[model samples]
Target: MSDEARVVRIVPNGPVMVQGPVRIEMPDGTVVESDRFMCAICTCRRSKIYPLCDTSHRRRQRAKDDESSTTVTVQAPAEA
Candidate 1:
């Protein structure tokens, strides 16, 4: 690895772009590592693969008059 500093970019309403290879430690004390040139870290927690961006933050398309257009809100569980 070069002595150069790694870059981290925050995308608006999206994932955080990180220059890899990187190692991440989860709340459960598990360690995750990536050797890619770049990594997309999830910020919305909507990713099926936690800590990795799967583009799940992107909004789904719906017709203006679609009955399913009704929005449902969910609250995150309170931290202990």
Candidate 2:
């Protein structure tokens, strides 16, 4: 493999897979580095650890439904 080459793969409704070691520059000029061979960058913003994927992109389950409806359902779009 070339020294300058890295592979980035995008998962279906998930994070962007990036080959590391990667240095991420935050908006405030903070630098975050990862020495792992591969890293997952979060796209969903729900992660407590921002800029890193913690599998927070998955769909949420509603805890309760209205009294009028006994069953509640959710439909997510198919991956493109």
Candidate 3:
């Protein structure tokens, strides 16, 4: 991202849509590039496509649909 870097919005229970010259780093020390200034990334961290929005999480509803649907939410919920 640059000085005028765009902000990536992490929607609750949804994807991380980013707008910018963003760089995506993989767990295997590989890096991916964003084509445009706007892109939707998986927030579930279960994307087979890694750094790209494959919609697999939405299709499978794996980590989502549960109580902890968000990975970037600020506050923790009260225990049940």
Largest lDDT belongs to which candidate? Answer: 1
lDDT of each: 0.69, 0.65, 0.60
TM-score of each: 0.68, 0.65, 0.54
39-65 per-residue lDDT for model 2 (tens digits)? 778888886456776566768633334
lDDT string for model 3 (37-71, tens) is: 66668777766555666566665544444423223
lDDT, residue 74, candidate 2: 21
Return the TM-score for candidate 1, rounded to 2 decimals: 0.68
lDDT of 1 by residue, 15-41 (tens): 899987667777665566666688788
Model 2 misplaced regions, further than 4 Å: 1-4, 60-80
- Model 2 pairs whose backbones collide: none
Clashes of each: 0, 0, 1
> What range of 10 consecutive residues in model 3 has the weakest lDDT sum?
67-76
What does candidate 2 score on TM? 0.65
Clashing pairs in 3: 20-37
Ten residues in sequence with the least summed lDDT for candidate 2: 66-75
By TM-score, the best candidate is 1
Clashing pairs in model 1, backbone N/Cα/C closer than 3 A: none
